[model samples]
Target chain A: MEQGQTMRGADAVIKVLAAHGTTTVFGYPGGAIMPIYDALYGSEVDHLLSRHEQGAAFAALGYARASGKTGVCFATSGPGATNLVTSLADALLDSIPVVAITGQVASAVVGTDAFQEIDVLGMSLAVTKHSFMVRSIDELVPTLYKAFEVAASGRPGPVLVDIPKDIQLAEMQYQTPLQALETPVVETISNLEQAKQLIRASKAPILYVGGGVGMAGAVEQLRDFAKQTGMPSVATLKGLGAMDKENPLYLGLLGMHGSKAGNLAVQASDLLLVVGARFDDRVTGRLDSFASKAKVVHLDIDAAELGKLRAPDVAITEDLREVLPALSMTLDIEPWKAEVAALKAEHEFNYNHPGSLVFAPRMLRTLADKLPEDSVVSCDVGQHQMWVAQHMWFRRPEDHLSSSGLGTMGFGLPSGIGAQVARPDAKVVVVSGDGSIMMNIQELTTIKRRKLPVKILLLDNQKLGMVKQWQHLFFEERFSETDLSDNPDFVTLASAFDIPGKQISTAEEVEPALDEMLNSEGPYFLHVAIDDAFNVWPLVPPGASNSDMIETLEKE
Target chain B: MMIHALELELHQRPEVLERILRVARHRGFKIIKMNMRSTSDVDATMELEVDSERTVDLLSNQLTKLVDVTQCRVLSSTQTAQTASL
Candidate 1:
């Protein structure tokens, strides 16, 4: 197996993917990519043919997030390759390991403006974690394998490999995957002792957990660390599943759209242990005001992220799963527990509001309560996304999937399909806004055709709810272009695709609607008309610090 | 702000320059000047002068992490003239 064997570049591509333990791939085939598809003809790997290249890319992303493995996707050159750009950017921002393989024009006509020729490698530069344009026969095998290595390694992200048609057809002496070993990422804790000292000396310490905790498989470690240290933790949207909701020391998600207590705790803390989470702008509204009182200890696998935004008092660059338990054993903080408990009680998520208007948050909470504990909810970006984040109960990080960093709309349907494929036993649901569901509404056809049991929960406010809330709050209710009152009847739309669906408008209909969606054995769509006046609470206004997060807006 | 000079050894691959520059731009470091010399058919040496309000060690550390970059180091302050000549 260590010896080199002769094979076509296209065959080598398939071999490399299989060697990396890839069980499935999402792709669409075309002229330039014919050879690769031809090579895949007799292979045991399952290749899902999506309706669009974008859908394929997003499905791959969802598969990666759900399975905790590098997702593989393939597309032809030009439009097919270009369509993957959005998902690539989304994957890069969210740090999902996705390997996107694209076909290109023949090597001879690469720069000659050949039909369907585009510089895919050049276009994907900004979005991909790394990219390789296979120029030679020998480069194909190593490059493809390297793409997997880089995509799944430290601070995982999307990687691209563009192979010209000629190269795919070319014969090459390929080295076995075992012979070409991936460069192993060595973990080094630069300042572990110093980080422990900071954690021990603080009276009021908070664990600021992020998506990295989940990516690094450190959720258990984080829980153990928090439990032992008596440190109340607040998670980012991506960090939702990292901490158990039942844990008393666990505060709800922090930052913009965070719980009132979570933001306040971060603002009040003396020591902020930032584990696996970058201080994104959304997490720290006005940078200076966020955690201004806290001495920071930032630990991440990526060294570049250490001092990129907020400088840490102690920075430890190491895998979270390793660093967390090591530091947890050194902690002895019993005095901080009661103070954190008090803050949790003070800033609890209040579901009770004064009106009979159907609150979106309450509806989502009810749905979450009714659903199975292992249910995976894919959410599109909007008020609904924030609502789900604030209310949904997730037992694990991958249970709730959102385009958090890229804030990409139309991510729900495709991601739901991918999640269902990845976890067949778990119930898969997509929570989308009326405005957002329309972005990739066509995926409904894909869902129906694939026979995937995906439940679609549509919160229709008849407007771009989040944007409308912003316009109402920040722009004095000018309401410019945010309204979607003229939207088509979603039930009818779902019916056209032969997916069973229902529409609900009142609070009484909420439970039954959720039951219908959950009880059904196949695809179901539930469209709930929510109150347009409802906005995600505990929102840190733009340019304001996390400390200035407003729990509710004043009546107009 | 200080003018920091760094020497980087990189793989001669497509868009390598843009990727390196992107990392610098992301860190809010401004590129004052840059020169690339092909040391071999596969390897290249890049001399960069960056204007930054951060420590040179930080930038060097990040640069070295790039997949294309095999080696990166911040030169002494006296080496600014040598980079200017490049």
Candidate 2:
């Protein structure tokens, strides 16, 4: 290829993707994007055809999250682009880097209500970090490059580029633009000293870790800080695997439906070192009383997040990799550690259930213990999601993928497909509920088409368990539109996709069924049926302080 | 409600103003009066008077983060501004 050699803008799109090292993309084809699909027909870059546009974008999100690379997805105009909004919003809230390219109606007919055309740029502005409508062939290449850069840069997020059909067919000279140099991070010595002084002065300091540690690639630095200070720690939902689960001083997760020990310890702490995590409403129930006594030291990469919800005693918007190491120092907090340990011991989860019914929490714990060293668990939202977060543990932040910020229900199956594609050899499992699995249930064919050796664990309670639980407690037991007693036979459903599966309802069958699922060579589904009587315990009633958590129905 | 005036410098993009106003409105600040002028072909400046009970940083911090916003400053805040008389 010569420097000034010309090619279709569609061809330039694929070339730019290759230049950026995008090996695979997830998408579906429709009317407006045919030209780009034609260009991708025989290219070296592989494309996984998802059943729906939402699935495509979610798979891209899964791929990006698992590999720490920018995930790319494509969709056609109007309906196709509209279907992608949910996943894009998911990526935006969770801060995953995804580049979505949508084909628009030809520029000439764009404003005249052309077929399959809508105001995509206007719709995207609310969901994406930034968006562009490429009006000409000259802007196409530069916009694509900028989309990739913006998606992966500071506080990574999804970026959308809408290219008109005419531009895709028009010829353009392909030239790689010069890369922009990154600005250096400057850390002030005064801020570091003030943070150190706060840490030194506190009698009980706890590290409230979040997803930023993993996003910054600063887990090791955070761990070193924890080890040096001998501080007790707790993790947010997205921050589950950021700390070593084996650390005696690390409380599991702190929030609604959080471990009682974790919530109580946070309430008792004198100083909170909030790292890479916003004080989300879920994480901080009754904001006015959350960690009421703790003096805060907040550190994150985003300057806007520093004082957004909870103002800090010392706010440092520097790289966590640099700041964590600078702030690490030995401390004497033996009594605090002992207190946290006692809380852990007192409120430890009891796997003992009275009947032969299969306990989902214990089953998840067993699965977590049995998982291989290289495994990723993509969980959907609901009761099963909470149980997975509570019972399962991961080796790294990337290993556990959940729709933390958006709490999207259909996230598990497609994200699992993407994770499996990203890590071919790593065992990827999708933990979905009866309600959540139906949201993206069409993805089963995607697994069969690609022969991805992914595993599915469907926890079935025949109800929208989370909402039903809320209704049971808060709405006088009016379980309106929450019952799903007509759920299809899950094992037979798996067989329809040429996937082997087994249904287990009793405690006696749990272990053997799990073994069979794990041992299968191809995709396998294990559907576990449990009674809907159980609910997520230790819930802090909405707007209640963390200290006011209700342990069970009797306690409430 | 308190009244605050904001000064902003932005890169000249077709939808740049929409981006700024969207953030301001979403963050609970209502723009009561506004003015804009082209500083150059590639740059533009805007003056905005907004009314909100929330702290101005809540809006200014978010406005500063938009990709097209080059600069943002709070000019003044007043407590006695009448909402209906504006």
Candidate 3:
């Protein structure tokens, strides 16, 4: 057989991936996976050589999250595949699309002790959305195709495809899948009569939107539903950018460190129409008190979340893509829109007013204004992260990426790199807290090495701000071990990595600092110092109802 | 076929690693790959894999005084297995 005509398994894998527009792959080469890497030499797909297998997985995660595409990562078996477990689990929990392919031991050495051998399939079962072990080399193309389809569709998450070493070397003819991949449809319980009854009976109706709204690509439907129902909608951190923040109905993010107006609106609401969001702890401060007066109706794709927490009065376990359209058709909410406008006139989420200084919230809100439409914002997990979710509004789908599930601290920088790589034309911004940035500060080298055009805004409070807030509120003011005044300057550190860095303190410097970083031609960092003693307000004491949020220390 | 508990503390430097393996070498032991942690940080934990049971006894008498190891012991994995059998 001619080398060019014969469809080798390695080349077939690339072709299948390329068909899905998987132009980029993150991986490291190893002895066991030499055949795949060797075949990749002539392919057009851009393969990023990651420093480690775990980094590759995380980078893939970042890419998928930013682009809403199935991210791919390749690794050799044994230790290489094992290293991907943590990142895989992270992606799985967050519903991020990741497809991990690992080259396993040779077919002859199956179940026998061989060099660089591992049971990759058995190890990844608990973490992945789906997993497969390829024995027949002929099945590789179909399996890879299936993996991408499963990963990208319906509650997207990481999937694993473990192929033995011999499978890569084996030749096969490429036969394209006959039909489009069919994903299982989750049905919504559209109790139209009940929905009408709930809408009619309620005095104050509010929409609690979540991350699934973006995943469903139902923003327009949600906007129309909001216009019809006249409900002031609040998004969870995961659902931050699903609706326009400037919209009158949009009430910003609801959770701990959430907007004061959003938190209060939920407390006052009589009917909560939750769309595509689980009532996570951050959203439901005091779980019992969350939307205390409201008759809750939750619409979600995952059935497990329907009655999970803050149990919904009418749970619709279906995609918001389908449910929102139904809501718009079943009822006319024009009169309710006036009532929602009336409610908005009474309550506001944006804490900023004229002459207000550039506080973290205002800074984020300004950045949101500065960001081009469809710009993706990735944030590290902290008080700053919550502020971004609440205050930094987004205008496009999947425009906001954060490790909401794992709540990993040092996720912003590398994730920003991944996001930028995924969509180089779309501007990427990473809003990271000082404490969170230090966890994987070494990744600064990775960003510099790639010369990715990513903008990083470091919120410098010089404290583990979240922990200290809890300490002040619950631990009798004893802020044990969560302060950071002694650490080296991050701006100075950024310079060492050859990335241009700036330090800004006053409000006068913030805009100029932002302008400088934005125009710096490549990767840049802006560090802004705010007061360490500043506490994130509207905190609900653990185990308290969400409505029972203790606003400021004086409220106690 | 007796299950033994083995504990190997990987050193940062290769020469230090060479020096530390003497205790294992003098007593004669082979490690199993499945039950070990090899970190990218260069320091990791290793289990005996096969016959991890008498590993502590072999290292305890002459090796405790060997100058660099901070701590070594018969960990709870051995005890847990024994309890499981009972």
Best by lDDT: 2
Docking class of 3: incorrect
For all candidates in order, the CA lDDT equals 0.86, 0.92, 0.74
Q: Please give the TM-score that candidate 1 achieves against the real structure.
A: 0.95
List the candidate 2 regions with Cα displacement exceeding 4 Å: A182-190, A554-556, B81-86
True contacts kept of each: 0.62, 0.46, 0.00
User: Candidate 2's residue-wise lDDT over A1-556, tens digit each?
Assistant: 3466699999999988988889999999998899999999999789999999999999999999888999999999999999999999999999999999999999999989999999999898889999999989998888999999989888999999999999999998898887778866654634999999999998989899999999999999989899989999989988989999878888888999888999999899899999999999999999999999999999988888988899899998888889999999999888998999999999999999778999999999999999999999999999999999898999999999999999999999999999999999888999999999999999999999999999999999999999999999899999899999999999999999999888889998988888888888989999999989988887999989999998898432
Candidate 3 residue lDDT tens string, A356-429 = 24477777777887887757888898888877876667776578888887788777776777788899887888
Off by more than 4 A, model 3: A1-5, A107-118, A180-190, A317-319, A329-358, A477-481, A554-556, B1-86
Give one digit per residue, the lDDT tens place, for model 1 in A1-556: 3346777889888888888888888889998999999999988688888888888889899888887988899999999999999999999999999999999999999999988888898788788888989888877887887888889888999999999999999988878654445545546667888988888888889999999999999989998887777788999989998997888988878888888888888888899999888999999999988889899999888888878788899998777777888898545555667777887898777778666557788888888888786689999999999989999888899998999999999898888888888888889999999998998888888788778889999999999988988998899999999889999999999999999999988877777778878999999999888778778887888999887778788572
By DockQ, highest first, what's the ranking? 2, 1, 3
Candidate 3 global lDDT: 0.74
What's the DockQ of model 2?
0.72
Q: DockQ of every model listed?
A: 0.51, 0.72, 0.01
TM-score of chain A of each: 0.96, 0.98, 0.89
Measured with C-alpha atoms, the lDDT of residue A230 in candidate 2 is 93
Among all windows of 10 consecutive residues in model 1 chain A, the one with the lowest summed lDDT is: A177-186
Q: Residue A136 CA error for candidate 3 (Å)?
A: 2.6
